[model samples]
Target: MKWKANTLSLRSLLCMPLTLIMLSTSITSAVIPVKTAYGEAAVDEQQVRTARSYQATLSDWKRWAADHAYALQTIQPESWSSNGGSIGQDKFSDLDILIPLLADKRIVYLGENSHGVAEFNLVKTRLIQYMHQTLGFNIVAFESGLGDAALGQGRIKKTATPDTMRRSIFGVWWTEEAKPLFEYMKETHKSESPLRLTGFDIQVQSPLFQNANWIPSIKLKDRALQAEQEVHKWRMSKDQSGFRKAKPELIKVYEELLQAVTKNENALKMDYPDEPHIVKLMKRALEDRIRVIQEFNELCIQSNLLTEQGDYSGAQSMMEWRDRAMASNLAWLVTEVYPEENIIVWGHNGHISKAQSLISTMPKSMGELMPKELQQESYVMGLFMGEGQAAENTREPIQLNPIIPGSMEDILAAVGQPYTFMDLRYRENERGNSWMFERMIASYQVQMPMPLELRRHFDGVLLIKQAKMPTYLPDTHK
Candidate 1:
């Protein structure tokens, strides 16, 4: 069989041994010459079935689009790069279709299989701009530290520099492809209605990094900070023994910090009688932050233990805990932080998909745990590539296998457009039932097969037929 020049022959990569990369690094480390995120769990080889052919003819697609109700006429060749370009006139205009589809939705999630793809960064950047200008989606919550994003947004108000954006989000996004979005965010601050940025993660290690004020006790905070530093040091050193030693110490100190904050609520209110409300919310935020550190550390310990016992899937299943905590934090942001505003969530497809997890026994995902209102008001669009080089932030780019037969990528590849979108929300047609409910390949990284029911997972899907190596920015500040 003839193979595409760009497609690599590494289908056996996943069949090799599995290794968890990092525990405390900002990005979740999967493992390899290239480890991946979107839950760094290992899968059984038998469970990872071969890609099947889902390719359909043009007429067949017409019927599917007619049933799904929309097949966006995407502009060919980097139409998403136009500056302030409007619909029907510019390349970015194809994105305007998203405005209507997302209308009346309270939250919108844009997901990526790999964070290191250049096209994903650029397209999502353009989407953020379009949504902000036309749809009034002023908030963009990333998968960064809650406090890190808060600090970054504050700096955006002050400088709005690209460096600040790099520091605020995960390390995976620190690339030239991702820089334009930060610049756009900077420009927004100068506008009448600035786009706001925040993180929906519980990964912030220090309470002091948050907007939270009136935190209790200097002694406890100092000790917790010191412990966190040690844990971070050990993690970065890749010294497992050091990490194991430092982790428990940090956990102990953090638990004390949580206890101290909980105990001081009454005292803080009494001390600051005039600012009771701010004190309460701020103090509660401190508790929330403490819980984040506690939960992450606990998950790491459990994962390490499970790995030692050879329970690889169970070790990965621990991500369900992390995602649940993140969902709770995101829900808090919606309820208490931006109750009236429309929210745009940037995260991994694994976290954003409303469908059950195909890798984990727990099955539920962050989208499933999102606010109950999200069932009716949320739209998630997953991103994928047919074939080309895909990069992970921590490693060099890898050549993805050519579009596998019977995969969602194969069906999407048949669309003929270099760039295209398919709305999965509508399923009014009875024809083409196999591709509808059939599980198909939608790998997280390196062409690894992890199939799922197409329509059940995403409201829509955006496909970039090829990926290029992302131009990496300098190492991040954090």
Candidate 2:
């Protein structure tokens, strides 16, 4: 590779794994070694996937664009940079920048994948830097609510103890890799911290006290069964001919009870002290389902992504479970909202997808969740991996099966159709192999296609790439 020759430094040559050197002879050269954000050793091109022939040709990309009814020529790449350079060529995969679709009108949501922890953190760190410096975005919301609040408070002043700091600010669920970014924000931004972090997990945890599983499913079922029994009792007490006379009154009672439960934050606190917000929200969520019973099950099936033991039925059950929680959170955000501008959501790839994403489980899209005017002004971008060439191993054998060009049907047959490609890293295949496996190879696994419906809804798309390495923002202009 061009980068390997005359680029490898003495320090890097001494530091690179002996195994990698033996696997790729071209990598043994002299150049200055660049360290990662977390001070990890820099990786060379050999570590990335070997470049592959475009599986779907540029024509195929255009056709897929046409299939989606998008104006291919109209969807131009937006201008963006680390300092002021285009992505690829000299920057590391983790340091690439994404051009914003909404410019200042909306935020660019960067996703963090759970499977690849290190890669997730690297990209996250660079993204934080870019958003803060270039975009001047202020809020950094995580898959958490309470944690964000804690971080916000902590930033104002150090109220948390050392050991308790991370827990209070990010919650127990977050991985260690994600915390450094917050710390960096706190230190760099200080009282004027541009990167504010928050978490919904914390607020939910506060109410539940124990794990959500400890809520006792049987007890919940009993409550539902009791509500049904009451209804039956009311029906039996009235005469058949007079049923219509009492029907309105009986129905009114049930509706009133549901509303009361949903609004009674104090009642929720009595039952689940730690999770009053979750309980109150859940009540409202349940009412929503009861109002739309038939469609309820279908919505659930579409919202769930990963499951331990679930088919469509299981997905529905999971959705129903999550829907209530999501609704409750939404209610809180509605009533007790903060800044409307520059809010960044950090979550897993599945949750960020416009199609059946984690956020989709909510009553509305993240953009829709905002106030109507905010909805028009706000935008969302799901950061995803590209099949470009960042995921190759030198020791492995290369396989090449370029995708059949101009065939969305074939691409989806190999992968799935109605998909939107989100290549945040612009990684291509190194082994040059491409036969549609049911799942993606780990190297090229970060592909999350936007659904056809969602792609059309966006003002524009800002695909990120890391083709270049160790270069500044201005390099892209060259």
Note the residue pairs that clash in candidate 1. Answer: 31-35, 52-405, 52-406, 53-405, 53-406, 54-406
- lDDT, candidate 1, 1-478, per-residue tens: 1111222233334233222232543544333332467656555333223453434343465445434333435322232223332222244455645644675677999998887788888878877766776667878999876656665665564553665766578778877887777776766555555677877776643334222233465666567566656544442342445555655566677566556656776754553332223333444444554564445555565566667778766456557776887788788878787888888999988788886665545447888888777666888888887788878667477888787765677666666667668766644334453465565567644466676777778888888887876888777344
Clashes of each: 6, 56
lDDT: which candidate is best?
1
lDDT on C-alpha atoms for all candidate structures:
0.64, 0.37
The C-alpha RMSD in Å for every predicted model, in order, reads 16.9, 20.5
Best by TM-score: 1
Q: Give candidate 2's error at residue 53 in angstroms.
A: 16
Candidate 1 Cα lDDT to native: 0.64
TM-score of each: 0.72, 0.41
lDDT of 1 at 2: 17
TM-score of candidate 1 to 2 decimals: 0.72
